[model samples]
Target: MNRSHELQLLSLEMQNELFRILDFWSKKAIDSEFGGFVGRINAAGEVVPKASKGAVLNTRLLWTFSATYRKTSNELYRTMADRAYDYLLDYFWDKEDGGLFWECDYQGKPINTRKQAYGQGFGVYAFSEYFLATGNKESLAYARELFALLEEKYRDPEFEGYIEALSADWQLMEDMRLSPKDANSPKSMNTHLHILEPYTNLYRAWPNEKLKERILVLIKLFQKRIIDPKTGHFNLFFDRNWTVQSEIVSYGHDIEGAWLLHEAALETDETEVIQSVRQSALKLVEVTSNEGTDTDGSVWYEKEGDQIDKDRHWWVQAEAMVGLMDAWEITNDDWYFQGLQKAWEYIRANLLDTQNGEWFWSVDDQGNPNAKEDKVGFWKCPYHNSRALIELISRINKLKI
Candidate 1:
């Protein structure tokens, strides 16, 4: 097939997959009994009632549906977005404190009340998308409020980058890690990348000098602190003074942040920043394609020293497709386009659950889906793969070919 035909065919598949994803969430993921979406659906496609709801999952649900609604004006998507928005306000919002509570019980009672910067960033991301889709002044106000909360509580003035986690009342915490797997560092590339993502969306909804300035600061930080120039990988964890804490390389974040940082700069229209970031973004994509992507075009989970965890994560595949297409867009390189094609084929053949509605959490090196993980849970939300489809379809439509 010619390049234009190739693009057309893939775009059709992506559109189908995107709606399949949304339909799965709409039909199977909703929680009629407990108010918001169900907190946990196991690998067997069974919902676990009474599971604690997470702010990240809820907020991502809000973003996925709102963004789709914005594009298609689908009332079903609008209903899903409204449900997520109402649930967040009724359950997740920290009415007394400034930011969102991390988790809530199945019945909508706050459980893990500590405020996480990552979750807060998703709040900003989701609320901003909600506002942009519906023009709801209250959603925009909430997004702005979350932005101010992140600035006031998380942003470190002396050391620069934002902190990882704070107490329920927004005080410093001893165990500040987002999860047990993460190092207990005061700062993280993941947190900063997420914050940059939402801030970019918020700037689209409502451009303010302070928000744009923060976005610029974050773009620079990634270019300097997060990205290793020698290797084109992100330094995962960092201390309060911006010292690197870990050498672990996550291929997912490397590719995800590559396009995200570029997107941030594009939103700002700062020529110097965008020009600088373009080079880094292409380099990051090239490096990830070289070092981290498998021969089968599946992106690995992480690399520590000489040991590479060979598990093909679902999120990594999603981001790799976008990053590869992004590089192709910039350079018109057939290498990246081929990489995108191979990676999407890999996902279709390996990661997708033919029996279930949504994609599997991961497939091992031997190409077997790990059946132990949750299908939909705190970590497994609709954002990554859905966003990839959304981005790819939009970009493909704009292609001259």
Candidate 2:
């Protein structure tokens, strides 16, 4: 055996980045006024006191810190996770509706009470991880409640999919876009992909039969609808009847879903499902690498047909490292390992803020960092990069070095 010298060196970088990412969030994101976490931090490293908080950011904070604590048993991580949990329940939870509000004012009052299925999925994901770390019954109950609520309210019977969002009380909403850039469609690969991620995490703590079934269904759904067979990329937006509504190819989601789908299948007892997922997962990796990544090793943001978005976004690079590493583990291919090395190098050279603690949101075509984007905000939570580092570190430790 070569003793995994290559992986050992890479693991050192990942461990360092993991701590930096967590430390930055802990020190800067805590809100003294609002109870949960701060709503946003501008690009200049200044916190926006009056910025509204989001369920997505808070729940992702809960998940990231809880996951870090579970693996390391660090008291500081536990305290941070506790803070996220306390704030999440205190402000974000809709007691009457049994789901989380989409957004809240700086004073912790609900401003947008719509129940986005995506938000509820993170609720299950975060609460389940917290329960795993602490064995807290209340957290477990919340996780299960969110899981059930998602099934009851979001699951589409006719399409065997999920609707995007509903009113606070679960009534159908006319506008179903997850974000302004997103198409107003009932079903989306992004939503379904994220829902599958949380459900997979929740199954780790509960492992109920229904949860397993849903996980299996979600995996098959990816194969049948979410992933376009010809391109091996995700179909971004979709309608109620499982029709793909947009032609956008989200490289981050494609690569992330590659490994995630495989992870979901592994949690189940179905042999056929695991085998099917294996092939689909590998195809996703291959296609994304071929079309979605640059020669310098960073993944692109998105592409449609032959038109590509050349800018490198923070989350895209974070996911690319993990996705390539996961592909290496699946096939034991040095090619994927090489890709991972390139991604890490690119991130270090471009996205990482050497003077600051966290990473830059993105670098443009000329390799200049995008300064207008929020350093920490509703969409810029610590989940992607932190999770990527954690995943890489954990996987490296498992190798027979």
Candidate 3:
């Protein structure tokens, strides 16, 4: 088949998969007893009623519903977005603290009230999309509020990058762990990549000079510090003084940040910034394409201290699609396009759970799905894969028109 025909077929399948996940999760995973979505759905697709809710998972659900509604113009999707929005206001929002909490109890009462910069950024992301879809002035104001808090508490005037985490009252914290898998470094590429992402979406809605300037600085920081020019992989952890603490490379963050960095730079419309960012991003795709991607076209997780996990993570595959597409756009390379298509094929064949609904957390190196990770949890959600589909549809349509 021709390229166009093949992409069209893949796009249709992606849409079906996206909708299937939305339907299944909306029907089963939502906490009717509680206000928001449930916190944990175990590997067997069982919702753990007592599991604590996470701000990241709730905010991502909000983004998914809002984006899905905007893309499909479906009232049901808007209702889902509204459900998540209400729960966010009621549970996640820290009225006295000025940002969202890190974790909440099963009944929507926040227990671990640490104000993570990552969670606050995603709050801005979800609220901005909610405002865009519904034109609710309150949602816009909430997004702006979160954005301001991030600036006030997280942005380092001397250091130039956002701080990793804070107390409930916005004081700096020492144990800044996003999860058990992550290193307890003072600075992380994951936090900064997310900061750039929400900043891009926030700028789309509320483009004030301050926001623009900070985003420009953020784009430059990745180009300078996060990205290793010699290797093209993102350095995982750093100290507060902007010194690299580890040489560990995450293939997922490299590819995800590649396109996301370009998105941030392109949003600013600074020719110099765009040129530099495009070079780094395209080179990122090239280097990781050589090292991380498998013959089956799926990207692998990182190696740590001589151990290669080789798990085909769901988010890595999703971001690989956008990264390859971004490379294709930058260089007009047929190989990048082929990479995107093949990666999607790999996801559909392996990562996607045709039996249960949403995707598995990962597949082993040999292409067998690992059944231990939760199907939906603090980490797993529809955001990564579904957003990939939405981004691909928009990018391809832009190319065609």
For TM-score, the strongest prediction is 1
| Candidate 2: residue pairs that collide | none
Residue range 49-138, candidate 2, lDDT tens digits: 799999999999999999999999999999999999998888889888778999999998999999899999999999999999988889
List, residue by residue over 1-401, the lDDT tens digit for candidate 1: 78889999999999999999899999999999889899999999999979999999999999999999998899999999999999999999988886799999999999999999999999999999999999999999999999999999899999898999999998889998899899999999999999999999999999999999999999888988889877888999998888888989999999998899888999999999888999999988888889998898899999999999989999999999999998888888899999999999999999878798799999999998989999999999999999999999999998887
Provide the overall lDDT of each model, using Cα atoms, as 2-decimal numbers. Answer: 0.93, 0.90, 0.87
Off by over 4 Å in 3: none
Model 3: per-residue Cα lDDT at residue 312: 92
User: What TM-score does prediction 1 earn?
Assistant: 0.99
- The candidate that wins on lDDT is 1
Which model is ahead, 1 or 3, in terms of TM-score?
Answer: 1
Q: Which 10-residue window of candidate 2 scores lowest in summed lDDT?
A: 1-10
